[model samples]
Target: MPSNKAELAVRIAAAQPGDSVRGLFFKTVFSLIQQHAGPAALESVRVDALATNYSDLRTYPVQDFLTLMYRAADVLEATVGPENAVFHACGETGVTRYATGPGMLIFGIISRGDPQKLFAGAQMGYSAAVSYGSREYLSTGPKSGTLRVRRDMLPPAYHEGILTGALKVLGLKGTARAHAHDIDRVDYDIEWG
Candidate 1:
């Protein structure tokens, strides 16, 4: 790995408590974008609103953000193969709450799965209520849904390296292209770097 990239990864790994993970992740991704895609590329990239449930209360410095991105990249690389890409924050933006148990934290990735397609699907979904009998219209809906299907195409190898760097920071093990499940969710494309 290049020195600058390695340093960034290491810094992210070294992040302590009270840091901003989301902010750092965004900056890191932007740095990678500037490095590979150039300043012009930044203009093309559009960050969606933080998911409704997402909160900024959680503090993650650069290191924490990098660690999370790295872990996510590891999962993607195992599924998609190495590629010249980077991970961006997707899904609900908020303090990720953990249950009082052992488990892995979940994150989402957004990419140009089918560059050939003209439109990318929305990342979230919801249901509306309809009246039954005596009650007026009331709806029960999901908070979110799968945004896109896994394209099964591998990204370039460098992309995987970025993810690997991030994972090393968190000291977490990642599986290649594992099928993570959510009710009524679509398959997300994953690859290993």
Candidate 2:
């Protein structure tokens, strides 16, 4: 975990070049901060860390989102526990919010209550969400698959939360283990009913 604000800033500055995330994520995280820590905390993160206001119609740099996520995790960690746990829950909520909202119709039609389709459809979802990285879901068996992501901007735990959240929202029992090959790469081994 980042030991202090400066460390966090350095981490954000280290984000990959030319990477950006959709504005919906900004709105989602702002809502998360407001829900967990209140308006003041949200405002602080927005102005101090993000250096901008939330806008659902524009894309923001990956570093800005990282700052928001890390700062939000720091604020909510006291109430939510460890940093990983906070990020995990945030990931879960992020995906849940998106999957149930703007992404609803498309994901619903693509997934059709099937995990395989959901996994395959995730690539499209990823494309719609971020301007960097690539996600590929390869089936290993009838009930298992590997979700490989390259140049991922988020932490491994966050992606783990994403996989689990996706399964949960689909009402499937499952497990997802994240394999972080490097800061920019991760592979998820997933099994579901």
Candidate 3:
């Protein structure tokens, strides 16, 4: 997991030319930690954003990724604003914008007015969460789907925010309502205008 995460981090960083954009994610997370949780908490989290300052890709523990997600989400909620949703949009938009190779194919498919492709991309994108797998029902209705993920992993509203924001960025109107049926998976009923 550590090695795979390192490779992915490097791959995402390579979406842009410079190293500064490479670590912008961890850098933003660390800054939020320092501002809200203070230096001690920041130190406890223990991911040095400065490592991304160079043109090299750094490998961080997989736990760091998980921790950052929760902490960053917490910071977003505690800070009070719509800024946290921006995190999702920023990452997705970055990937959509600077994407090359196979990503170009993805963007192309998405450009031809297919909302199902968007959900497919979201399904695959969220799959990056360690070994998590999402089950998406894309053939249900017109530009509508059901995305199911672990209930305990992320707040349902976070997923809703990401869906709405990302779809808006992609020039579609998206709305999500979450339903938790059991202790395992939560279903996000997604519809777009």
> What's the TM-score of each model vs. the native?
0.26, 0.88, 0.54
| Cand. 3 TM to true fold | 0.54
Worst 10 residues of 2 by lDDT: 1-10
Please give, for residues 63-163, the per-residue lDDT of candidate 3 as tens digits: 34434555454444444334335345334433443233224444456545476776677555443322343556555687788876652333345456656
Encode model 1's per-residue lDDT on 1-193: one tens digit a residue.
Answer: 2123453454444344443433423444444444554555544442332211222233334343443444334333433333223342211111111100111111223212221110121111010000110111111222111123222111212223322332332333321222323211123322222
Q: Would you list the rank order by lDDT, best first?
A: 2, 3, 1
Per-candidate clashes, comma-separated:
38, 0, 0
| Better-scoring candidate (lDDT), 2 or 3 | 2
Ranking by TM-score: 2, 3, 1
Candidate that would win on TM-score: 2
**Per-residue lDDT of 153 in model 1:** 19
Worst 10 residues of 1 by lDDT: 125-134
